[model samples]
Target: MLTQTINPTYFIIDFDSTFTKVEGLDELASIALAGHPDRVRIVDQIRDLTEKGMNGEMSFAEGLRRRIELLSANRQHIDILVDFLRTKISDSFQRNKQFLTEYADQIYIISSGFREFIVPIVTEMGVREDHVYANEFLFDNEGTIVGIDEANVLSTDGGKIKLLRTLNLSGDVYVIGDGYTDYELRESGLANRFYAFTENVQRQRVVQVADHVAASLDEFLFHNKINRSQSYPKSRIKVLLLENVHPVAVQAFEEEGFKVEFVKGALDEDELCERIKDVSIIGIRSKTQITRRVLENANKLMAIGAFCIGTNQIDLEAATERGVAVFNAPYSNTRSVVELAIGEMIMLIRNIVPKSNQMHQGVWDKSANGSFEVRGKKLGMIGYGNIGTQLSIVAEALGMEVYFYDVVDKLAIGNARKVRTLEELLQISDVISMHVDGRKENANLIGKREFDMMKDGVIFMNLARGHVVDIKALVEAVKSGKVAGAGVDVFPKEPKTNDEEFVSELRGLDNVILSPHIGGSTEEAQVNIGHFVPSKLLEYMNNGSTYASVNFPEVQLPKLGNSHRLLHIHANVPGVLAKLNSIFANNNINITGQYLKTNESIGYVIVDIAKNYSEEFIKELKEIDGTIRFRMLY
Candidate 1:
């Protein structure tokens, strides 16, 4: 959508630390020699040798010999290691399980790691046997001793190219992963693009050589700028851009290697509900509403982006209750908001709005009494979240006394007060600022009653929620001089999208600062917002992290215990969870660590098992009375 360029492409990803969380060979070292302190030194050496081999600092044969001598590893370690690698699939890779199955022909595994461990891991990633190419290990009759097959090309120079020749792959080859071996796939001209996928960990050497360095998988899809590969129709993921997104935001997804379809015009709730049929990722700005119907009809919908601040437009409770994670920009526009608040305070206190209005009307209304300096003023803050808290420091540095009121206890960053109630702060402050955010209960936090409680000649400013202050009541207060001046930045009837017509009721008012919701609209803010929000979303997509997420459980998905598993995303209604347990019970599936995480609309339940189960039945369980999306990835 950002660039009118689309192409067909195929990706050959690497294993080890790339597809899985840990390096396969290193994992083999750990599980095999758990209590042996001596092997730890060997692991460090093997790691260094492997790095050298990839970087061409040492020959592949030389590196392998050094590593083999260091470990003296046996067949027993590999047996345990195979079980460990089975559980380390990356989030971005795991989410694209359908793609792996569908694009089996185009997807290949090219790694310096052993085929013994890598093959089994990729199989769990939905990759078949014939598609995987790696080094092989030789086990003796006793099965305690081991040796690697020197016959394989991976044991020597230009090894990956030889393996590729055997496959005879067609289409633009994209090599994505970390490590020097992965980089060599490009250096030898075996791949068209060497994408340095640093989503997990970054390497300077890999980054320096990569045609492109993707911080996340979504970024990889966007930069590649390819939508669908003709080679893989059934498997090609169709990304739908619902509502309009920033040109840069669209580019970010395209580079990550997906085919994106963006519809620019605004749509009603019913229209959006109808449009999400085939979209894998539906990206929208603040306008498009992602309702329950839209979610239910989004048969292919994977993720949703609010694309702007405050996800009030979408039903978040419904989203969380339905097992959907909604992403938004939290601190992307922090500085812009603080500056706007300071400017509004100055404008309201100095009577700039009235002066400007009179000048525009061609009248010389240069009255001096109303206009005053903002030097010695007491500015009371209503909330102390990011924006409010930032404004506090800015206000205090400008010789203004700042008093803050927050229901949830917030530590005052600068010298600000934790007032017991709104009344206590209102009685003393000269300029009362309303910086409270959007919570359901804050519909009319500031009204005639609260305004009447303020100092008789105090000015007021609201740079936060539109509905926080009753606009009509404030307008009446300003008109009657009950409040000396008012600066209103937002309104309850604001436009949903950039294409809509915005109308305000407080038009043509004197001594009242009216900003068209420009509290967070600086170029710096916009640019940072464009990059930061998508980055965090991609981080969550690649790793199951919820750092800046507005709606969803915020916790790190720690290492998985010894087990194959079931991951279910379902609607958070009654009996659905019980039904899932009943199905497991009927199947006699022993469960471990069944983590249940929810926001408001959806529930994400991760199930681990000690035994193997048929994954094909997962599709059937999806139809289970109230089942949403049941995924059994082992």
Candidate 2:
């Protein structure tokens, strides 16, 4: 491990929007001026002033003076503000309390905000009284009105820099805050570097000039080589599962000592975005959409588990770019879907759907005219993947000749013939079934031209993606008797929830079987997916194994033996590996084992070293030029 010659002596932090999620004065105005005549006008003015001061458009002293004048608050309101700020602490900062307490002497809170609210909150973090450099308010005899202490150095525009300069700190100084005043500390050369803190608010002006940008306090601690395990335990990690992801998933996560919050149904974009802010992992079924906007707001999310076959509901590209791995149950539900396809094929070939519908309508025409046996009928399969290959073996056992067609060159199962073209399969087979993915190219894959190629008494079924088949074309083919019977488990336009009404073109057609997308909704499949996906998610989070990730570079690592593992994700570039090795060598740390994997966009490296490495080694590894994210797994 490596050691640093000069550790930071002072950690000057900002108070208002840096430590808390909301501006203290703005919140105070809302509470204090609740029933005032012009409460809206005053609250707007206070927010505008806060923005002006934080963006460097106006002096901080002027902004504070204007905000306090408009607040019209009393000493009683200060108590309310303190209690509110107590709840508004940054999530990541609160999670790393031990780090703050361990470095309390080196950390300093210098802000233009009043001491009334700052003291109670900072003290909870184990910060000493002398370490808090803030302005104090003067209260009257009745505790009804307050005035600021003009003599305090923090009341000025560039007060942070001026106060830090007077302290004459011995070692390197690092400034972490959200506003212009915090940036001034590094601009004036009093601090070594300025980190633009954006866990609560992100000011473009400050971020543009910052030497580094940190999303949360965890980012700062990780970069500084501070072990977060000292503060936040793995048990505190939060996992959210929506769309009724099976209870097995909740059990798996809870068994591993994680806090799991299970929601019964899907959430809209706005609701999901708000709920996902502090969640570390999310489990979703087909109904829940993990869009790009959701991924952008989920700063704390480390991984996602798609508890079904397809990951089309999630933005895998965006998740990978943000260092969030995406895992799916690609093989877990294969058996259920194959069984459903086989059952539907038998029902369609025997004309059971029309006969069932006729019986319900009180028609007694039970003559076996169109109904046929499945003894020697030819069956056609498309997309010979997991479900297709498995279905081939079962169809052959049912005394059906299987003819398969796939874009890829797949090996044929027993007695199953591979056709040269989809048209060739359509010409000879008596029944056709589709099982394709959700790729854009698969939309309308079976259209009018291909439907015209089928025989007059052929049966058709689609249990795959809804958009893969042309519903209008299928309707016309059924009406014209070109296709004798059809069974469809999926539709292009489906109701969002089970309570909603379902509308389809083939609703009242005889000999047509329409199901509500139950191909993979069996109890056995859901339970298997629940167990399978959560295990992959936990494996990636705890061991840094991306073996089944749909988006990230794939790497399966063994558990470190009495060693510490460092996971480094970086842009794919030259010399990054050499730079990482050099950092370890310079610190005299011996590497036990290392694994590296890369794609066109990113490079993932897992380094295992003896347990005696110094914190300086972590700091040096983070300093590498191309580092995107770094985590220590012990």
Best by TM-score: 2
Query: Which residue pairs clash in candidate 2?
Result: 1-589
Give the count of colliding residue pairs in each prediction.
28, 1
Residues 240-316, candidate 2: write the lDDT tens digits.
Answer: 99888888899898756576899887788899999999899999877778999999899889899988788887987
Q: Return the top candidate by lDDT.
A: 2
lDDT assessment of candidate 1: 0.72
Off by over 4 Å in 2: 1-232, 614-616
- Superposition error at 113 for model 2 (Å): 47
Give the local distance difference test score of model 2: 0.85
lDDT of each: 0.72, 0.85
What TM-score would you give candidate 1 relative to the actual structure?
A: 0.58
